[model samples]
Target: MSDAVDPRRASAALLALGAIGLWGTLAAISTRVTAVPPFLLTGLALLMGSLVGFKAFRHKPPPAAALALGVYGLFGFHFFLFLALRLAPPVEANLVNYLWPLLIVVLAPVIVPGIAWSTRHGIAALVGFSGAALLIASSAGSLGQGAWLGYAFALASAVIWSTYSLATRRFSHFPTGYVAWFCALSGVLALACHAIFEPSYVPKAPEWPFIAALGFGPMGLAFFLWDRALKRGDPRALGNLAYLTPLLSTLLLVLFGGGALTPLSIVAMVLILGGAILGSRK
Candidate 1:
């Protein structure tokens, strides 16, 4: 085979794209899934992810990792995000959640000892928050009286996810093979929440499509592809490829969710993404 058709390179490229495609479509899916309670949806999607990830399961995680996963997987970003989806419009919710990457740039040093803060991260933080301000400001006029609750959860999703990202780095000895367990455990938590809160609601066939999409794609194969890409490919190129996620995600939301792009939203996207890239520079 020609060098251009190298098996490893081809597979990596395809997997990376698949992961990106799944993530990009999630907000659009959220629009169609409003009738589902966040936790109930989480339980089903994570159960599906768990089923696909069973091959990667090993023994249960160590105690500290398990504790962390309780927060990280069950009651943290994974949970908060789906809840945010229910609380806010998909576009606004997703934009706020995008702050996690910028937060991660700022937070990594705090979680990982010996890593020093840098001017680039400071710039990224400033720029990222400026964009965030515009996003909130732009949306403020028409926000429902109690919509802050949703926005708050949206911001919480970023903080929780950033913490989880940092925690994973801190607990480097934890086995990545335990992803299946994490999903399964998170599914259990979601199931409990569903039992308590959504007993009266019954799922129809339409809702299953969104839940299943999240399970098989973003929650399942995307993670597998991310691990494979990091191990087999050029890190810098993959990192650059990762940048496409936000823009594509936003594009997908606009295209499929029937969302509009106000001038402020457009500007906010540019600033947030620009700030993140600037800050992420080593």
Candidate 2:
């Protein structure tokens, strides 16, 4: 494993930032497209993303390992994430799903040889989890039985995503464009699952653009950029940047009347961002 930063790391950071920002805004957009069922929206997004990914793939083909990684990404991460969102509120779903970084931290020592855990990292994780707890308690009133189920789904999603991230290292020799193809393939699989298990789903005319946004903006380009970044940068650094999603989403919620930005949210943001920074440090 190389510790040297790639010159392209800056560009990858920018792309990751854009992706996280778009993902943060997904809840708002999805709300507007309520007429579109979650399954249909996910399926459409995956299908559209696959089209983009396939075009990229034509430029370069990935190894069997990369494709295998993508298969896990589809069935494990995306599928569970969509299901979680369907079962819970976006905020809750995101909070649960984002726990993957912590999962990765715990698994890294076992998966990545010679990686050692430190007391500092443990403290940082504790702080981050505390912040997450505050956020959950602050918004606890919004959750219900369905949201609880979504939390379960979201936790499962975190586990799957952590696995995907860890396993992807095996495919690092493949081109980033090839990795993009695998992501697209994952999306395609997600669509197939949607079609099989979630029949009778149809999006109204007004919902088309929202579905399109999910596909092209977040699902398509975001995944591509993320994979490219991970290829050139440290996963922990990327994970640190990923913490911005919750902070950004909270801001979006305040702007859109989802909730008032309370003192607890402010405190939580500090904890999450601070922890992320500490945890990602070399």
Candidate 3:
């Protein structure tokens, strides 16, 4: 049993790593499509992501409650995130939004009955957040005094995502394929919001590639992998691993000409790695 369990745990970590790595590319890719409206971008990319569910389409659907929870997570998180980005300085909004991981580590016990929170878990989470804050703060400017609404929205995004992630474990009996419907339904809701609020504009030819990449990778396959990872792995450990996203994203941004890497980034990387390692301890 030990032999079998070890491999499963290893696979879960790898899967979580893969998902996080793909997410690392999100900032880099989004930079190229700045002209696209947020809602439309979300709608199109998520619609494309829904293709992953084609094979699962014929499977008996999960319960309505399950699908609703999925939509709440997928749509709700992005909805508030875009609002935060729109209303606040993008960097500040993003830093606030990244609180989801820490929330996960801290709130897991309350949300999931069998999970236990430890003092080490709290320390690991703060250490990881400190690393993320340092990394993100390196790019941010002075905080906007008047962007309270945006900050609130950013906080809401964090709460939505963290709760959604924890709630997913409650519904683990639902097939992973149901994620397709989740994506599809979420895409529809996004598009509907886009139609109702945002000015309509067609995506240009050059933008399709980036949109496809977003759909197929971070916003697409990443969700499926995340679901699998959470189902098989400890969410507390996975939460720490999530801190790597910002560090990796910053590096990718530097690679894509979005920014320059600094010595601080190296330090941030170390803190994040150390926290993840410490948090993963049994």
Candidate 4:
């Protein structure tokens, strides 16, 4: 088990917050980056993140377990995530994907062993799901075939992300940077796959800046913070933090001139935030 009071927890929380915020902006930015294929963008971001994480590799090589964990973290979790984003709006996709926190609630006892399920978890799940349902229902009328497909991909991403979270616990001894590198390697592998199958794909000069932003902000720094959080805090505790994504995304959407805050959305946000805070407390 991880020691309590690990300073990395705070850092991770901040990173995760920043990541979600960047992710919220992805929809707005991705529309402009349409010149680049999603796979290429994903690959480039992974490469950038890997480059950022290279400093960690200089000290010592990551072990096999860390490498494996990193692979899933980078490739499995992110590949599906990119796929989902390609198919759906970033805010909608994220709200659905954030369901992983609920999944974590269901799986935590089994994965973490000693941690017992509690009423607090149940209440949190109810509140989170209620919020999610409200959001989905509010947006349901606007969805198309592609959006539905994206929702499916988002759900799949959630499952993979939850599994990745469980897997990370196995390599508790690995340095955060080492784990980040492994994640980058996974991103590299995904990029390689994309290159082989989609040789024609390339980003134009205009899109390069957004691509760079994706790399440094969401892909690179975000993962580093997430890894640190997972190392320092309980997965279940961190999982509750997933609620922040939807809340933040909704707010960002409004700020970006997407839509006015509907009554239902406001109610949903209250429920999600309330549930997450309650669930996070010991």
Which candidate number would show the highest lDDT if scored against the true structure? 3
Among the numbered candidates, top TM-score falls to 3
| Model 1: lDDT of residue 53 | 66
lDDT of candidate 1 over 68-174, digit per residue (tens): 65347435776677677678875577667767656665675677665566766666666766676565456444644336677788899888866665555465555
Model 4 C-alpha lDDT per residue in residues 1-282, reported as the tens digit of each score: 454655565665666566666655665565567777667778887787777677786676677777777786678776777778788876678667777878877787777656578768867877877786676556444644457888898898888888777656545667677755775677778778687756677677887888888777767777776766666666666677666666676676677776568888889888888877877765
Using all chains and alpha carbons, the TM-scores for the candidates as numbered come to: 0.73, 0.82, 0.95, 0.82
What TM-score number comes out for model 2?
0.82
Per-residue lDDT tens digits for candidate 2, residues 64-156, read: 776777777755786788778887887678678878767766665666445566666666666676676676557556654556778898999
**lDDT values, one for every candidate:** 0.65, 0.70, 0.88, 0.72
Point out where model 1 deviates above 4 Å.
Answer: 1-21, 58-64, 80-99, 132-141, 144-156, 223-246
**Best-first order by lDDT:** 3, 4, 2, 1
* The 10-residue segment with the lowest total lDDT in model 4: 137-146
Cα lDDT over the full model 1: 0.65
Give the per-residue lDDT digits (tens) of candidate 3, residues 1-282: 543456666788899999999999998999989999889999898988878777877877778998998899999999999998888888789889989999999889998879997888788888999999889878765555538899999999999999988888766787778889899899999999999979998999999999999999999999999888888888888898899999899889888788887788778888988888888776
- Superior by lDDT: candidate 1 or candidate 4: 4
Clashing pairs in 2: none
Residue 254 accuracy (lDDT) in model 1: 73
Better of 1 and 3 by TM-score: 3
